[model samples]
Target chain A: MSEMREATFLILTALADEVRHGYGIVQEVSALSEGRVALLPGTLYAALDRLAAQGLVERDREEVVEGRLRRYYRLAEHGRTALAAESARLRQLSTAADARLRTLRPRSV
Target chain B: MRRLLFFYPRAYRRDRGPEILETLQEYAGTSRTRLAVNLIRHGLRTRLGRPASRTVVVWAALFTVACGLFAAAFGSWVGWQTIRPLHESEAAQVAAELLPTQNLKVDTDEPPAKFVIYGQPLGWYSVRDLLLGDGGEYGQSGVGAGSNGPADHPERDLATLRENLRRGGWEFREYVRPDYGHEVYAGRGDQQLDITFYEYNYGASYISLGMDRPAPALATVGGVLGFLAGAVGGFLLFGWASRRTRSVFVKLLLGFGLFFWWAPIVLAFPQMVEHHLSEWHYSWHPLWEWLGQPALSLPFLLGTGLLVLALAISALARAQVRRADDPVPG
Candidate 1:
């Protein structure tokens, strides 16, 4: 399986919680990633369009609170499944690395 | 900056022009040393949908050159027509009469249709109508050239003169003003005569005649040449553009070809070949004649239609072949 980039992982993780508008999703992902990535508007929208085309996410609803339109998108079942598989894969890799590092530790002589 | 107005999609510009400008201003403000480079790069990308590649620049240069050549060829064609007299019988004789006495120089070696007199300058329509036979008041009035001020009414004078000539036994069957100017070709059989008047001003006029030859041949050749120039220019532009976008190339070719063929032709360099030319004849009393070199516009019309049809078919075939090679994913 291909490893998901941090940004993609954070996006999928944010949507795993609940449906969110574009701005809300951005804020949620930023908070979850601890400010490591600041996605530009172009990058964010491009990713969203691609993900939506793949049937991983979809527009759930739309509402206008002010002059601007707020579109909400929800994670599809396939997206949740993919996120779970990515998480499990990452956990296995991390565990194996930790074991290797412990064995390489220098003993007190 | 102004041309950037055409860069964006029309609907998008209409909706967000001010907003886009405001955003660009803010973006540019953050950079000082990189301002020019940044804007130029972004502008190219936006207008061309690609970076400023050498290929794109080369294509643009090629398009500009093709357009320039087409304009030059058109100029040459029109210039040749303006100076040469075709064989027009009654009209040629009338044009010859209208010439001032001092300008009546003719060479026996020259064909009857090739005679030209020089003296005073006259407008194109005034000479054309008189030589080709007038369409009466409406035509004269529409061109603002009826027998009033030469600037505003050459048509009227030419019309009245044509009516007189018609009554006086000059015969005109059909004619058209392809470019500005008048011509009449007459005679009984395969042999014909040509008379043309042009560049008239004040009371003076310049006229010429060629006898015993058909003027229709001249008209046909000129018209065909003009049509070819238009189609060839469009084809060159399409070839240059299709490298990047086939649909855009096809659309532009069709649109531009139609525009050149059907639109009212406006002379590009009108002032260069008028009024002050030494060949204008101004000394003679106005003599009118009726004649015609019929079917002038046919070749241009037919040629344009044929070329457009050919290009459209080629484009369709290319599109079909491309689709067959790469079927779309359902």
Candidate 2:
């Protein structure tokens, strides 16, 4: 499979631990990215629909709160596998970059 | 939030509208303009469906361009309706007044119709003839006159005819000499005149005059507007049909329709471009000819029938139901 986009990685990461509603995912993604990635409703829903279509996510349940519909979503088995593979790929890259930076640091000093 | 939800397709809006609205309300402090724009963009995308299929876009684009071209041709035809047809007597009278010698025998033929196939008006009876070898004979109608024999003092006669046309309010452009003949073009208002003189090595020569009208400005303007409208409408309609059905037969019908309709245009466009570049045209050939219209009317009609059938099948098919486990409601 191709490497996951940063936004997709973050979104999948946001859903890794627990099932979340739309706004919950939005808030979590924002916090995960240190307030750098704020997903609007339209963008977030479109991504959710694509993920669900790809079988990476599935509807967990639904509730009514203050006369508004709140639908929750959770990662599926395929999504967990994909997330783990992507995480491993990123960790390897990060470790290699850190080693290179450490070697450059002593020469610069 | 409700107004922004309106941008989504009807089914999608019904399924996920409330959920999306609730989310938008939570982000109430965010820019409404940005939210609205994003909603509109994604809403239109959702209408197309098949999110993972890249070919859907290519098919939609092809359908749109073909539809736009056909609409433009129809608009140009409507514009042509404004022109007044030239009578055979008018052409003969002009020929008689312009001829230098009274002895030259001139014959004038009346135009059968605004457009004709093999000198007759197009009709159901002529469809076979059109589809056969005679298809190339389909052309615009025009009043024409020709001299039976070579003109006496051909060079002097040309000057005399040019002077006579000038006196009769005709504005002459520079004459062109192609492989076949020396041709002079002139215009007065909507009326256009082409005078061609053919000379052979054995001193055999004759003059032919063709009188018609230039394409009206209204046709050009209307054609452009029609193309724009047709393009947008075709794209939306194609998307609607594509998303409404998953049947393989319907997709095949659409493919066949596009092939039949677009093939003639694909063949004729480059040749027409070459013709335009190689010749000095007083008035352009009618719009239909470029589309290979009545000439290729058989295939055009077949394509139309196939598209109608495809759309009918799509209409009869049920819309795809959202899966229970999908996060989006429908």
* Candidate lDDT (C-alpha), each: 0.47, 0.81
lDDT (Cα) of model 2: 0.81
lDDT of 2 by residue, A1-109 (tens): 9989777888899999999999999999999999999998878998999888888888999999998999999999999999999999999999999999998886555
In CAPRI terms, model 2 is classed as medium
Q: How well is candidate 1 docked (DockQ)?
A: 0.04
User: Across residues B1-330, which tens digit of lDDT does each residue of candidate 2 receive?
Assistant: 588677668889998998998888798678888888778667766767864454666788789999998888888888877778768876777677776463334354677687677778889988788876467787667787888767666677788888888888887765556665678888777878888888777776688887778888877877888788889889878988988887899989999999999988988877888997786676777777788875677788889999999998887775334344458757
Residue by residue across A1-109, what tens digits does model 1's lDDT show? 4777777788888899899876577678879978766543323444565578777788898665544455678898888888999999999999999999999999999
Q: Judge candidate 1 against the unseen true structure and give its global Cα lDDT, from 0 to 1.
A: 0.47
For TM-score, the strongest prediction is 2
Question: Cα deviation of B316 in candidate 2 (Å)?
Answer: 2.5
What TM-score describes the B chain of model 2? 0.77
Over 4 Å off in model 1, which ranges?
B1-330
State, as a TM-score between 0 and 1, how close model 1 is to the true structure: 0.33
Isolated chain A TM-score, each model: 0.91, 0.95
